[model samples]
Target: MPVVWSAVGAVVFPNVGGWLGGLITVRNIKPWYESLVLPKWRPPNSAFGPVWTVLYSSMGYASYLVWRDGGGFDGPARLPLILYGTQLILNWAWTPIFFGAHNLALSLADIGLLWINVAACGYSFYHINHTAGLIMLPYLAWLTLASALNYCVYRDNSTKIKEVKKDE
Candidate 1:
């Protein structure tokens, strides 16, 4: 198959999840997400769309590099690609878990797993293609911030906190 097909396939696949997440996000961002006691460090709502656009596109290209140079799923890239997919699924699940279901605890757990999986994915990619590995670094960094945010959100909104506030 042509490289374009592979590249496009890789690129579009992740965005499909992003698009789906957006659908879930749109319905819940107002009244639901807005009502949460988010941390001060949370980025402006406007920042997310652009940031994720870059991250998703970059990660998608990184996957393409691994797929092409590592010889697709039939070869060395198999495990790495699987790691990538696992992380992607975790990534995709975050929106529904947090925004759609308004379950901060489960979202935290999902992103926590995602954080670990992404590190492993990046490591596996590095072994196959250095650039692919390098490309995933930003994603890992973003997850660091995201994981912290998830923890904060979960903590701030925990039942314990709610009970404490009620007692006050």
Candidate 2:
């Protein structure tokens, strides 16, 4: 049925972002990331995978609810869906920028945009489906925390960041 496919698509979409992020982050966790001057507030690296898994799955399910209730993909739901897609891309970009490129400043900027996109997407989703909007709240919260973490790293490791940037 169409509903089933929509649900599947919803879940799969963010997972694609997750998968791409994993490709960049998994290898870097040991040496590169561990060496960083992370904040005291930072969660353990082990916490990230499980948290993201739940967030991505919930995001997909929320999108599915929006799609199903907003008259399907081709109907009035287009704007919110587009916003969601945009945020998803931004979400995917952050990990690579941070871990792969080791550009904390750029990563912070990227996540700032991501935060805006997520808020807009949540707002748009709220108009289409209330519960759908609610689902995005956790993601928004996480982004807030991530933005802070990124800022801290950038600030605390400015000299190192400069060296890394200069090397590139």
Candidate 3:
């Protein structure tokens, strides 16, 4: 019921899943990740941390806005919150699938679903609070880049049999 409980506690802490997941999954993935035939425009590895930090914080705050405006779980915010949580889970799953398990195809599937969930979540949030929905746009933008990168990596790096040469 206190402001601190509502503000500090609510606004400041939603990324533990991401931080911990990255820590565990990324611990030994550098070499293999470095070996991938990435697109010419792929962001430097350092970019991801700062980008995700901002995005996570943005979405976290956005969720709080929706919760405050829509009266949390008992009201209109319920489905939006569930969509937000679902996207969070999908977002958290990507690194483990890509870096830990080395499964590019599956990673693409996960990210694709993540993108859809985020869009749906944003739409739902918009109906409740404009700021909350607007806040999700950057995350969607970043996901756009990430999804394209994932698709390219999977296409270029996955194994394939060379097509037989045809006689002229």
Candidate 4:
């Protein structure tokens, strides 16, 4: 039972990070998001729930595998796992900036960093466990698409924060 609980925690931790990010934006974001000119290829709003659900699951499982293989909190394998935590934190920051605060430019910047950290995590995980890194490839691909989407939204929507402040 204890091992099962541990596995459950491993699988849920990453999704919890994402959920926390969404919770931060739960109220203030809709109007700004609805105003954007998204690409024709963008999925319907409904698609995001399911897509993120699966993606988060994959992320959680990969994280679990890394932790299981890499040893406990203070093990020699801690380096890759530490990068994993960093990437997750960056990932968690994107939604609130993009949705809650309606800062598309900031969101773009955050996503850009998210992309880099994810790649770094992937590479580090590859050295730790090849399959664990492979599991994150889809996540990297999705973030690539999301970063492009974020950039497009920023270009089509918000003025530079500096410009807005000057006008104010």
Candidate 5:
């Protein structure tokens, strides 16, 4: 039972950061986001919740495995943990920027950094524990798709003086 709880905690903790961010400002997101020209490849709105749930669970399990392996304090394993923490922070920041503050440009920048950090983490994880690293691969791939989507949103919505002038 204790192990089960710990496993559950492992999946939930890292994801809570994003969940909290989204919950805080979910109401403000639709106005700005709905007006944008999203890429055709954008997944259905229904896809995000379930996908993230699974991804975060895998991430948490990976964290638990790394921590339990006695590699948390020091080892090559520590590198991925550190990278994971960094990326998680960046991940949480994106929702507030895109949704709460309505700064899609900043969100795009954050997502770009998140993409890089995930890559770094993935590489580090591979060298430490292959399974732990493999667990993160889906997350990396999803983020890659997300980053492209974010880039498109930013490019399409950027405030151009020419467009403003034309509107006037």
Candidate 6:
């Protein structure tokens, strides 16, 4: 059935983003990330995986609800789905920009864009399916926290970049 595929697709898409982020993150956890000056409020590294797993799953399910209710991805139905996909791509890009490239400032900017996209997506989803819109709330909350963390990291670690450049 089309509904079934949409459901499966909703979950699969965000998980793929999560998977790509994890791959970039794993290699950088030591030396690069561990050495950074983090905020006192930062959650333990162990907390990230489980939290992200739940968030990604919920995001997928929410998207599925919108798709199923909107009568497939055509006309007005396409906008929310497009916003959803855009946010997912932004989500996937954050880890690589932060961890892989170690550009905290750029990562902060990327997260800012991601936060906007998420809010827009949530609004679009809300227009289609109220529950789907509600599902995005947690993700928006998490992004708020993440944006704060990214800002903190960028502020605290800026000197490290300067130091690296000085040595070069």
For residues 1-168, what per-residue lDDT tens digits would candidate 5 score against the true structure? Answer: 987797788888977886787585557657656766778889987687778878888988887777666357576467778888898889888888877766767898899999899888877777776787899999999998888888887787776523654797
Per-residue lDDT over 44-152 for candidate 4, one digit per residue giving the tens place of the 0 to 100 score: 7766766777788887777777777878567745887888888888888888777877777788888898899889888877776789899899999999888888887
- lDDT at 77, model 6: 58
lDDT of 6 by residue, 47-93 (tens): 89888998999999998898878875874659999999899888999
For each predicted model, how many residue pairs clash, with residues at least 3 apart or on different chains?
0, 0, 0, 0, 0, 0
Output candidate 4 Cα RMSD: 2.3
RMSD of each: 2.9, 1.6, 5.2, 2.3, 2.9, 1.2
Among residues 3 or more apart in sequence or in different chains, the pairs in candidate 4 whose N, CA or C atoms overlap within 3 Å are: none
Off by over 4 Å in 6: none
TM-score of each: 0.92, 0.93, 0.89, 0.87, 0.86, 0.95
Q: Which tens-of-lDDT digit does each residue in 1-168 have in candidate 1?
A: 688997988877898899889989988888767777889988888887778888998899999999889888899999999999999999999999988877778898999899999999999999999999999999999889989988987887787546756897
Q: Relative to the unseen true structure, what is the C-alpha lDDT of residue 65 in candidate 3, on a scale of 0 to 100?
A: 86
Query: lDDT per residue, candidate 2, 1-168, as tens digits?
Result: 877887987887788889878988999988988888888889888888889988999989988988888886788889998998888888988998999988888998999999999999999999999999999999999999989999999899979867877898
> Candidate 2 or 3, higher lDDT?
2
Query: What does candidate 5 score in Cα RMSD to the true structure?
Result: 2.9
Compared with the true structure, all predictions reach lDDT values of: 0.89, 0.89, 0.85, 0.77, 0.79, 0.91
Please, what are the lDDT tens digits per residue for candidate 3 over residues 71-138?
89999999999998899899988888888877888999999999999999999999999999999999
| Candidate that scores best on lDDT | 6
Candidate 2 has an lDDT of 0.89
Which candidate leads in TM-score? 6
lDDT score of residue 13 within candidate 2: 78
How high a TM-score does candidate 4 get? 0.87
